[model samples]
Each structure stands twice: as C-alpha cells, then as structure tokens.
Target: MGVRLRTAMLAAALLVAGFALRAPFDQLRRYLIARCNDPVRLPRLAEESRVRFQPGARDCAARVAEMLPAALARIEQEQGRPFANPPTVAVYVSYEDYARAGGLGDASVAAVARSGYVLLSPTLCGDESERLAGVLAHELSHSHIFGWRRSWFAARPPSWFTEGLAVMVSGGGGAEGVDEAMAVRAMARGWAITIEDTGLWRDFGAIGFAAEPPPEIFGGDRFAGRQRLAYREAQMFVAWLRRIDPQGFARLLNRVENNESFKDSFVKIYGAGSSRRWSEFLAGVSR
Candidate 1:
C-alpha cells in the first residue's frame, strides 16, 4: 500500500512539473503575439522599422491589396516586366505613431525592398477614400522600382530621381504644380535651397545641407523644412521629365531599375549627361 501511494505521488509531481514548465512558455507566446499586434508599441521599436499589422490595421491592408494590382499593372506598362516581389505594407492611424516610425504623412515612404511597408495616418485618409488609394499607389511604385534593396548599396540612385519617379508614377500633378509655384517664389526671394544642399534626404537625420540645427520635425507639429523642399523639387524635376519625353522618362526608369549606370542611362535616353540636362531643365523652370 505504501509503495502504491509513493507511485501515485510521483506521477502527480511529474504532471505538475510539466505544466509548470509549459505555463511560462504559453504566457510568453501570448505576450509576443500581443506585442506584435499592438499598434502603439510596434511603432516605437525603431526608425524605419516595418510593423506588419496594427489593431484596426486590416482595413488598410484590405484596401491596399485591392488597389495594388492595378498600380502594378500601370508600372508594368511602363517597365515592360513584372516586379520581383509584392511589397509588405503596414498602416497606422496615429500621427504620433507615424512620426515615431520615421514617416511623414504629406508623402508615403518606401524603404528600398526588404520588407517594404506603408505607414498611413488618419490625416492621409481625409474625406475621400480615393486619396488614400492614390497615396498607396505612389509608395508602391517606389517599392516596385527599387525592388527590395536596402540603402546600403554604394552606387544607389539619388533622392531626386527616386522621389521624382514616385511622384510621376502616382499621378501627383497638383502637388507638383503647387510645389513649383512655391519654389519659384522662394527662388525669387533668394531663399531657394541648393540641390547640393537638398541631397540630405539620403541620410536619416540630416535630410538637407542647410546650416540650421537638426530639427525634430518628425515628432513635432511642423514638417521638416528641408525634407519638404526635397520632395517638392523632386516632383517638379520629374514633371519636367514627363513633359520633355514621356516615353523616354518611362524607359529611363526601367533602365535605372536594371542597374544601368546613371550617366550611361541619362546619355542614352536624354542624349546628354544627366547633370547638363538637369541644369538646363532647372534653369528653364526658374525662368
């Protein structure tokens, strides 16, 4: 009888130990999933980090899935080949969260390819739903064009070209016009930022070449002044390219994606060095 009692107690103790070990793991798994789906926590992880989903994120995901095929079709029409992979998009509703994630709502951001996602805020949704679709279409074009490459490449294309192409592809004509008018006025006032100075968009913190101290424009109420200028000038340059040779612009973009040297591609399409053509183009616009 004592032996039977000992056997029963040993079995009970083992069962209890097994559950004790599994309990923590079960709790940890739940915690991990909760964090993954937490809209607020995920955005705070890192700058330019991709959060796969947020609470109430399914709506934006569904909207993107619905709109992306058509946008891809347009891109294929221009490039003559399908994109390498479909992009991953993340949508957030909080402006604070959006800024924390290193994003601006005035434009959608496309990280070069590895797990590319879109960050959307309520401000971008606005009254019309189609506007959101347009924004997604624009950012997705960047994803498609860049093809999942990170910013580590030494010979990457410039911000002006990438951003200009995105604006051109997303059909952002009105914004381009508004920026051009503003730029013309700013230039007249002797306040125009130089292109060399504007190249700051390539870096994370310092997005322009001005002497002003780095501003916390991402989290604050205002837009980053230099970033705003870069986007505007990029749009105008692309719009100019479209006006000059629509088909050539399309071919040039395709060539860019194919890893063609920028100078070679420019000479082939525009019949001269890009630097020369860009200077002439800027001068014409300024006049």
Candidate 2:
C-alpha cells in the first residue's frame, strides 16, 4: 500500500508539472513581469502601438500587439488607404470577466471597437496567437472603416460588407469551419437563404443573399442554421467579390469610405444585376 501511494503521488506531481508546461509562454512571462511590475496596469508596446491590460488569461498580448503593424500594413495595402493614428488594442483577460473590465453588452463578443480602443478577449478567442491576431485585424478593420470615413455623420456600411471585408483581410475568411462542398450542396438542395440585406434570409443555394429580410431572422425554428449560413455567405461573397474585381475592389472600398452606400458602390463597379452576376458565378463554379 505504501509503495502504491508513493507511485500515485509521483504520477500526480508529474501531471501537474506537465499542465504547467502547457500554459502559454506569454501568460507566464506576463505573470513574472507583473510580479515585479505594476499589476494595476500592464502595457505592451510594439512599433509604438500598445496593448493595455491587467493580468489574467490574456497572455497573448505581446504577440497580438506585434502583429498589429503588419496586419495594418496589409489592410491599408488592400484598401488603398491608411490611418494617421492606429487605435490602441486593449486586451481583456476573459469573456466572463469582461464586465469586470468595464465592457458593455454581451461578453460573448470576441472583440469590438469603441472610442479610441479596440478591445480583444483572449478567453473568447482562445490563446492561440494566430486567432488573436485575426481578431485584432478584424477589429482594426472596423476602426479603419470609421477612420477613413472621415465623417462623424456618415452611416456605416452594412455589417456583411464590413465584417466580410474584415474576415478576408485578416485571412480568417473562407468557409469558416464549414466546407465549401457542403455550402454548395446546401445550395443545390435549394434550402439556401436568399442573398438580401444583412438582416434577412435563412438559406442559400450557392447564389448570394436576396431581398426583403424577414422582419426578424431570430426566434424561428431555423434561427441557428440561418444565422450560421448568413455569416458563411457574407465571408464567401466578399471573397468572391474581391476575386472577380481585384482593382475595382479598391474603388468599391474607397467609395464606401467616401460614404457611398454599399448598393451604389457595388453597382458602380459590377453594374446593374450584380446580384444576378453573383448567382451566375456560383452556378458556374458549383457545377
């Protein structure tokens, strides 16, 4: 019995050590830094950009912060515009603790842009550096939209265009965890939501969204399915748009920044029946 107990204890000790080793390196480094530094506020800076936070599950701060400059460069390169001042990236430790950190609305949000700060939660996004970087870039896109808009009164573009652009630019777009074939198959079944404004429709048939969104897209029996399909459609559509119109995409983005409505900007490039063109492209590719 004594020998068995010793063996069990040794195994448990090793297991604990293994778990500790699996902890993210940045989290550990920040912990050590916080021990000697101030815990009330910890700031990590890269290329004069900043990530402000207190210690918690938010250890990916330094890596994400470092990614900002390069991400911004890519975003600016793609959009044909730049910002005079980049928004500060703020890292909140976790989703559940977001309110404790002074966030509003649902903590379930992965990230958000508000005022002078772009808030990111590692807990919501997992501690993976790449995922966090994507989240940062996406939120930065939101900031870029506002910054380049250059007008406080300009109505923002629809969520689909804005969020889709963010996803593609961050390299996180493309089928999201859903397979392209599956999406195409869903389209073939004719159960796909129609491409319309960002608000409506619950299905897609390889073609893009279509008109007259339901008064409410939520609360239906198919709400979850619809919402999921909506996001996939948005990302895929933006990617398709960029793919087809490359240089013209820059013009479209500029028009949006110049406060042109998404409808006008798209029509200006693809001409009338652009939505129909999306369907024709889908038909050619899916078959």
Candidate 3:
C-alpha cells in the first residue's frame, strides 16, 4: 500500500514564552516578520497545516507542510505526548531570504520555533522530502517542548536536555552527527572534558539578548570554549540515559520542568548512583 500522507507543524527563552517577543521588530523588520509569519492562508495541507507564504516561498511552505505528518508523528512517538495545539508554520525559500526579510540571518539558519510559530528555510532542506524530515522533526521537537513546559514552570529545560532530545528524536544527521564525529576524533587524541564537568551542560542564563540575536545563539562556539562539543556530548548523554531508563527519563523531566535541579531530579528517580552511571557512560563514549 502506498499509505497516507499528512502535514503540520521559537526560539529559546522568550522563544519559549513566544508571545512575549521583545517587540524588537522595527518598521521594516516587523513588516517582513509579519509577512512570513502572518501569511495569508492557503488551503489546508494534510491533517494539520494551512500553508502560508510570503510571496517569496509559497512552494517552500507547501513542501514542509507536505512532510508534516511524519514529523509530528515522530515527535509524538518520541516525547510520549501529543501537541495541545498545532504549530503555525512559515516557510522561506531559503535561509538568506528569511534573514533578509525577517531581519534574522542567512541561509545557514534552517528554522526557529516561536511561541506560536515554526519558521523554516528550505535553503538546506535538500531536494528530497526524506532528507528534510529530520530538520522538520528536530524543529518540531523544540516547538513541542516549548509548549509542554509552560504548564509546569516558566523556566525552560537546560540547553543540553532540550537540544539533545531534539537531536535524538530527529532521524536526520543533525549537529549530533557532527558532534559525535568530533567527539570520536577528540577522544582518539585524548582530549575531552570530564562527564562531571558542569560546563558539559549549557547554561542558558549566560546568554544575553542584547540585540535581536546573533548567529551564536542559534549555533556556534560563542557560549563556551567547547560549547559545540559540549552540546554533542550532552545529546549523547541525555539520549542514552533516556534509552536505559525511560521511566526515569519521564520522571526526571517532570521534576526538572517544575524547577528541580538536575542532580536532585536524577537521584529522585535513578537513585544517587545516577551520577556514577553518567560518568561510566561518558567514559565509554570517550574511550
């Protein structure tokens, strides 16, 4: 059987609260942002999306919408939850156009999840739908997390936990793939931060939104000296931990979402030995 197809689908911090978007948009920026974001509605795509376009990328929005069912299903299956609301999706022909139009940045950027919308760029979505699915799934994970965490506390999950889960769920070879390769090469050379190093976990608090947002906030070495590698390591750690103990994963996230400290939450579910387990996992990966 050919089967059926369906379609669907922030930022960090205020990206979580999404609606509180600092009104950083000036006349031109606001206009452009609104153009893509509040696009005139097109016919509904599959079960979820009503494709929207900003004259420049109608095809891009349609392309992503065409792939939404698989992406949403993956998120639901991985997270063990369904979305409370369908995410608003805006597609740009390429990242460069999106940045220029929205005052965001170049085509290197793929998508951003906001409180109410998922902004996408087809620039790197590749030629095939299958290739693009991973990116869609990854961005959708962020949207899902942003929505789910609000009921517990305003605070967002640590960068590692959030980004790690997104990468883990995405079948695409995202930054995690690069992170893994980098870790392996680094490990071979006997260079890796200890699992116990707190730096391994990203602190979102240190990021200052002094201006709209620089490229570093999205990805790069701006946060920590080893920030990129730390992200990869964090993804590996969290994903593996979840695999070994899903019940613990659920409980740990529940506690953390409600503002529990990572160590406290880890012990509450997996016993104090959880830290030992983490160190062991780290050693194996680095070895």
In model 3, which range of ten residues has the least summed lDDT? 201-210
Higher-ranked by TM-score: 2 or 3? 2
Assess every candidate by TM-score: 0.60, 0.66, 0.64
Candidate that beats the other on TM-score, 1 or 3, i.e. the better one: 3
Winning model by lDDT: 2
Residues 105-165 of candidate 3: C-alpha lDDT, one tens digit per residue = 4344556565556766665444433446676777788778666556433445456566667
lDDT of 2 at 63: 62
Candidates' lDDT values, in order? 0.55, 0.60, 0.57
RMSD for all candidates, in order, please: 15.7, 16.8, 14.7
Q: Tens digit of lDDT per residue, candidate 2, span 1-287?
A: 69999999999999998876654554445344433433235455443446676475345666666677898898787667786466777676655444333233346456666555676755534643445766677778777876766665555566667766776787763224444565565556553445443221111112234442343533342433454455555567778888887988888888888877767667778875446666775686568
Total colliding residue pairs, candidate 3: 6
Ranking by lDDT: 2, 3, 1
What would the TM-score be for candidate 3 when compared with the true structure? 0.64
